[model samples]
Target: MIELRDVHKAFGPKEVLRGIDLSIGKGRSMVIIGGSGTGKSVCLKCVLGLIEPDRGIITVDGQDVTRLRQGSSERDAFLARFGMLFQGGALFDSLPVWQNVAFRLLRGSLKRPWTEAREIAIEKLRRVGLSPDVADLYPAELSGGMQKRVSLARAIAAEPEIIFFDEPTTGLDPIMSGVINDLIREIVVEMGATAMTITHDMTSVRAIADEVAMLHRGKIRWTGPVTEMDASGDPYLTQFITGSPNGPIETLR
Candidate 1:
C-alpha cells in the first residue's frame, strides 16, 4: 500500500536517509526498528509528506506523493486518507478529550455537524477502552496510559485506510504497554487498515508487526516476516534484538 524508492534526505553536510527502498503491503502492519539517529522517523515523515526528501519517490497506492503540492486540494485529499499517532500524545492542551478526538471531524472535508462529531468521538473513545465520562476530562486529568488511549482513539476516529503509529508503547508500564499493543493489533485487524509503526520496543513489534524492517545507515538493512526474524542470523539484527553491547552496529557512536 506504501512504497519508498531510492529515498534520500540531507541536512547540510549530514545525510540521513540514503536510498531507502521499502514497501508495506495492504492490510498489513510493518514495524520499523532502528537505533537512535537511524532516520526511521525521517523516512516516515518523508512518506507522510511532512518533510520533503532531497531525492526519491514515495507512493501511496501507486500515487507518487512527493509530487503532490502542499496546501493543494489533492494534497489535502491524500492526507485525509491517513491517520497518525505521534510519538508524543500530541493532544491539544486547550481541548477536551472529546474535542481532541473530534478535531478532524470539526473542520476540512471530513467535517461533520458538532453533534455527530461528538457522538463519533465518544464511540471511538469507547473503542479505545475509555468511558463516556472520560470524554469530558482533559488530557491533564488522565494517566499516561489513559492519555495514550485517548491518542489512539483520535487516530482511528475517522476510520482511516492507513495509520502511522510512532512509538505507540513509549511511556507506559509493561502491562499497559501490552494492553496498548493488543489494542493496536485488534484495531488494525478489525479496521482492515494498512499500518506502519516505528518503535524500539521489541515486545510491541512482536505483538503488532506482521512484518519487520530494520533501518540502518540510512537504508533498510534487513526486512522479512516477523516469524522469520529470529533465524535470519544477520549480525546487525541479532545485535539489535538482543540489545548486545558488541556487534556490527556501533552503539557508542
Candidate 2:
C-alpha cells in the first residue's frame, strides 16, 4: 500500500536519510527499528510529508506523494486516509478527553454535531479500554498509561485505512506498554489496515510487526518477517534485536 524508493533527505550539512528503499504491503503491519539518529523517524516523516525528501519517490496506493506539502490538496486527501499516534500522548491539556479524542471529527469534514461527535469518541475510547467517565476529564488529570490509551482512541476515531504509530509504547511501564502493544496488534489485524510503526522497543516490534526492517546509517540494513528477525544473520539486525551495546550501531555521545 505504501512504497518509498531511493529516498534521500538532508538538513544543511547533515544528511539523515540516504537512498532509503522500503515498502509496506496492504493490510499488513511493517515496523522499522533503529537507534536514535539513524533516520527511522525521518523516513516516516518523508512519507508523511512532514519533511520532504531531497530526492526519491514515495507513493501511497500508486499516487506519488514525494512533494505534497501541507497546503496541497493532494496532501490533504492523502492525510485523510492516515491516522497517526505521535511519540507522546500529545493530548491537549486544556481540552477535555472527549474533545481531544474527537478533535478531527468535531472540526473537519468528518465533523459531526457535538452530541454525535461525543458519542463516536466515547465508542472509540471504549475500544481502547477506556471508560465513558474518563471522557470529561482533562489530559492532565490522567496517568501516563491512561493518556496513551486516550491517544490510541483518537488515532482510530476516524477509522483510517492507514495508521502510523511513532513509539506507541514509549513512556509507560512494561506491563502498560505490553497492553498498548497488544491493543495495537488487535486493532490493526481486526481492521485489516496497513500499519507502519517506528519503535526501539523490541517487545513492541515482536507484538506489532509482520515484517521488520532495521535501519542503520541512514539505510535499511535488513528487512524480513518477524519470524526471521532473530535469525537475520546480518550483524546489524542481530545487534539491534538483541539490544547489544557492542555492535555495528555505535553509541551516541
Candidate 3:
C-alpha cells in the first residue's frame, strides 16, 4: 500500500502540487485523472522520488520513502520493488528488445545469469503478445504499438510488486489503444500488483481502475470507487469525466 500525506511541490514561482493526499490500497488499481498541468504526474514522481516534495510524507508499506536519497543503496533497493511504464516507450535504441527487457535482471540486486534472464525476457514478451523472434529486433524496427508492448514486457519482466503506468494508451490508434488497455487490465489483475496510473483517457480509466481519483489545482478534488464516479456530482469530477469546456476547470490559458 502507498500513502501521500499533505504532499506539496513547487517549481520556483509556479506551484505544481499544492497539497496532494491520496492512498492506493494493496493489490488495487487506482487511476488518476485530471486536465493537463494539474500535477498528476508530479504527484506520482514525488512518490517515486524522482521529484522530492517540498513538504509532507510519502510512505510505502508504512515506511517513509520521501526522505530516501536518490542513488543511495536504500533508495535503489526500495525502487527495485517498483516497475514503471513511461508515457513514451522510453526504450533503448541501441539494445535489442530482449536485452532492454532484461536490463534490470542483468545487473543490480536482482542480477541473474544471461541465459535465465533471456528466458524470462522471452516469457514476458509472450505475456505481452510479442513472439520470441521479436526479441532479437531493435526498437527501431517495431511499430508504435509494438514498441509499447515491448515497454510493457520490460515493466513486468521482473514481476515488480508495484507498477506505475504513465499514459499507457497515448500515441496509438483507437483499436490499438483498446488492445493496450485490455492488456494492462488483464496483466495487472493476473499479477495481483498494486497499480497507479495517470491518464486523461476516460475509457482507459474505466477499463483499468478499481478506484478513481481526480486531481485539480494540484490537489485531489475527488476520490471514489470507479462505479460511483459517474454519479459523484462533484463539479470538477463531472466536468472532467464528461469532457466539458465550461466548468470550474478552465480550458483556456
- Which lDDT tens digits does candidate 1 get at residues 1-253? 8999999999899999999999999999999999989999999899989999999999999999999999999999999989999888999989999999999999999999999999999999999999999999989999989999999999999999999999999988999999999999999999999999999999999999999999999999999999999899999999999999999898665
Per-candidate Cα lDDT values, in order, are 0.95, 0.91, 0.93
TM-score, model 1 to reference: 0.98
TM-score of 3: 0.98
Overall local distance difference test of candidate 3: 0.93
The deviation in Å at residue 233 for candidate 2 is: 0.4
Candidate 1's C-alpha runs over 4 A off are: none
RMSD list, candidates in order: 1.0, 1.3, 1.0
TM-scores, one per candidate? 0.98, 0.96, 0.98
lDDT of 2 at 101: 94
Cα error of candidate 3 at position 16, Å: 0.4
> What is the C-alpha lDDT profile of model 3 across 1-253, one tens digit per residue?
9999999999998999988899999999999999888898898898899998999989999989987888899999999999899888899999999999999999999999999999999999999898999999999999999999999989898899999999999889889999999999999999999999999999999999999999989889999999999999899999998898889887875
What's the candidate order when arranged by decreasing lDDT? 1, 3, 2
